[model samples]
Target chain A: MKILLCTDGSSYTARALDLGVRVARKAASAVDILVVAKRDREEKARQMAEKAAADLETAGIPVAIHRRSGQMTEEVVLQAQAASYDLVIIGGRERRGVMRLLLGSPALRVTEHVPASVLVVKGQARDLKQVLVCSSGGPTSERTVRFAGRLARALGASVILLHVMSQLPLTKSAVLDDLEASAEELIRRGSPEGVHLGRMLDLLATEGRTGHAVIRRGLVRDEILAESREGQYDLIVIGAHITPGLNARLVEDLSAAILLTANRPVLVVR
Target chain B: MRRRQGKRLNWRKPGLALSGFLLFTLALGLMKGGAGGLTPLLRNHLEVTNAADSMGFGWLMAYLVLSGSPVAAAAVALLSASVLSYLQAFTMIAGSRLGACLVVLLIGCIYILRGHEHWTALTAGILSLLLTGSIQLAALPMGLLILGRGWLDGLSIPALEGLAAGINWGLEPLIGPLAAFLPGWALFVAGVGLVTLSFRLFDRALPQMRLERTDLGQIPRLVYRPEVMFLMGLAITLLTMSVSISVGILVPLSARGYMRRENIIPYILGANISTLADTLIAAALLGDPRAVTVVVTHIVCAAIISLLLILLAYRPYERAISNALAWIARRRNNFALFLGVIFVIPVVLILL
Candidate 1:
């Protein structure tokens, strides 16, 4: 897999690079580092990209660095689309006002527009023990859940599947029953084949009463944010695919909303 | 202590009162001008009977509904407007019943403010409905006369007919040689330009005329319950539909007004008005319509829905209805589910 790391030469970018290197090492994927600079600052951007690329290469992670000019967010998105990279990793900036507006936060715009999944890293690295997957029982969500289950297993984390049953005039008893049936199906489908599967099923049957399912009702984004805040999970996995330009804008807008609101680091896996 | 209290009182904010006055003045001016300009245009080309014209009052009611929740307002408005067109085929009295209920509920709301020293304002709303209703009833004779004379041209007709005769009979003979010299295309361009200019001017000059911000801070404390919101949305849509249907059936004579060529304008206007129900319901259920800017958003969305509907006609609404129904199907067991499956399915299957 080709992993794209979007950098702006900030300290956050450096940390995100470190995290990307670690993730690439684990996933056995190649890292493609992309730096977007102002049109006039081509030399500066090239220098930063080169240094980061050399450092990652030295750390035993294969690196391919690319630099371009223009509005940072738009350029990065265009590059990601052009390259067709599997995933885009970017640093979350803490800048405010004009500087922040001009550079355009990569984490904000890329998450929304990019067809590939995005990983927005913030602050220090910690063990990812609990993975929460938001599911709507759609194909996109099923894919997300499967990916999350693998990541949880790798990290020795227990998976918590949450389904936000929006209170849309359904009786409480009916909604609860639907949630239970869905939870059972998810657990059954998510388990691997063979000896591991039997043990997983036994574990689920026992803890399924407590650890497995969570159902909340409200707006989609709000409910997701609320669950994250309450759970304080280390990473959030979301799905994405390359969308048309106009649809990208709509997704871009939604991504910006999530970034501004969500507290935890989001690992968007395609 | 008394002197200090007096000084503190003197320092109390002054700008709020000033701003309020300015906003009220601006709102009044826009309302007057908009009513004046659109009324004449609607009358001339559409030739809706006066009773049907009173349906415009429903527009004001819709504006109230939307003022509270624009997003939901826009959705409801789009659905209601599209449904209204079909409902008109049944009977004008049925349509009038639907239209009148909306108007009455909205106009009736003003009465709630009667005890708050705004009794006169409430009275004005009641009086406006009465006056408008009377005028519309009175205009029936004039509409009949025009129809009898074959002057009532439907939307399917072209704007121009017998240009040479019009120039000779209606222009040159009536207004003399100056009318013939007037560039018709230039005049049309100028008229469009003037309308655009007025709209811009009104938008710029009017302050309070702007959409009221949903007070979101109160959402958490109020009806954040999803069930409540769903019910409220359902109730408002049903009530609006029922009222529109009844008006169409009961006031058979007012059919043309409900189905005028320029019906899109009121339909668009009603889109904003219908949202007020959601906001009001939100306020009642949740006690805060703030977190859910559904109404405000819907109002903004109405412009998009209106443009699309005007351009695409039934196609856009059909897609929206289907999409909404599909969403309901996925979520399953909701009110929309029962309505879509139980109500729509049986009816459609029986018809098929």
Candidate 2:
């Protein structure tokens, strides 16, 4: 696997490098260290790329450095798209006040526009141990499950497949039939959500990993955050919320919320 | 072959559209001609003395008919005959909407009686009614203010006069014979029947929509966002010209586990605002420019209140509604108590 690691010489970026190195070494992946800076900050950007590259090299991973000067998110997106990299890892700053609400961070913007999967390293980088994969059982869910399964296998982490049933029944029969039914009951009945979860489990097994399927009922983002905190997962995996066509940007992205609110690293599958 | 199929005109659509339009115009002419005859019944027997009484009257009338547009149209007809003040007309229109939202609930009740779970069957309808009720009640003061100030009295559509005249000319032949035999009040009743029939025809004119699970799976989750759902409700109501049709779609979707309660509140909010489109046509048909302004006031006030709810307090409002739904569904008596309160409010208002 080929991975692109972007940095800007900040302490946050340094942590991102640490996580990137660990992931590259686990997957036997080659790393391309990227530094994007303003026109006047070329020297600083090059220095940061070299430092990240030197660290990756010492870890016995093949590494190359690429330095570019332009708008940070645009440049990162271009670099990710220019090559067929499997994943792009970047550092996410802890935004506060209005910044948190606006969510204009370069890390998030790259996740939205970039062509490949993104692993946004926020807060402290830690050893990969447990991974939480959020599945909506929608059409794009298979890709998310498969990607997270592969990541878990590579990192030797335990996988928890979490499906949040946020749907409220419109009829009384539905409540009596399914809404209040627990995950085990749903699986027994072979309900759609259950079947989807079963399929996800099968995918994980194919990736040489056994995953635990857990279901919770509530708001999607809130439940995912609750599970991540309670489970103490090292990484939160979610699908890239890409809506096709002209009104693509009009829809809300749940991954964006999980990325902003989750305390640990988040991997957005594209 | 695919391009050819796409280009097919499906003449049935235009045919139905023309039939619906003709029925609507004929219904309006009949109602206008018969409206003057109902003043005695409205004044002495019904005693619709004030705005509140008329509001209750409209509300109760909608309950009897299982629809709101006809009641709203009747309010405009009364206003055209000078039997109701503009404020009365506005409040009556508002009241019709509050009562109209219950049609979905009633549909849910039928499902419940068929051996479905009571709570799930009724929650969507209950939520829809609650959302509509809150926004309409909040819009009341502002709507009354707008009509009371006479700010929109001069807001006339010049084309309405010409349009009404042409329709009157076309409809006179069929209406003349009925007018000769029927008393004024009876003519009004017949006109209302015609109005109801016209709406049914219009409903038939709309394209049939069925949301399969496969289609829903492809829909992005963001489509459930408050703003997007708001626009969807608005657009669908605008097309269907009936809140009953728009909100009614929620029942089957939710029952099948295709839609969520969280996603529907904003949709109901949006549906409430544009559901006034049919009443606006009724006002224009009345040919009293002030009648149009009356309906417009209700529409504008509803739009503002709904927008505020969506913008300022959507998350909180959604939570509050969810809580209310749970509370109502916790026991059978609570739901019964809710029904009793809703039923009694209109009676009390009419008495007031």
TM-score: which candidate is best? 2
lDDT of model 2, residue B51:
88
Residues B1-352, model 2: lDDT tens digits: 8767655546666676778777777777677778888887877888888989998999998888888898898888888878788888888887888888677789788887886654666766787778878888899999888777877676656686678778778788888988888887787777788788888878877876764353333332334567877987898899898976775555555435446555667777898889889888878866788888998888899899989988888767877777787788779999999999889999999989
- lDDT of candidates 1 onward, in order: 0.42, 0.79
Candidate 2 on A100-205: residue-level lDDT in tens?
A: 6686667678888788999999866798799999988766788998988888899899999998866655544454456666766778888877788888889999
Each candidate structure's TM-score, on Cα atoms with residue i matched to residue i, is 0.39, 0.81
Query: Global CA lDDT of candidate 1, please?
Result: 0.42
Let me know the TM-score candidate 2 reaches against the reference structure.
0.81
Residue range B47-156, candidate 1, lDDT tens digits: 42233332332332233332212222222222222222211111122112223323433433344344322211222122223322332333334433443443422211
lDDT of 1 at A24: 59
Model 2 alpha-carbon miss at residue A114, Å: 3.2
Report residue B58 deviation for candidate 1 (angstroms): 20
Interface C-alpha RMSD per candidate, 1 decimal: 19.9, 4.0
| Winning model by lDDT | 2
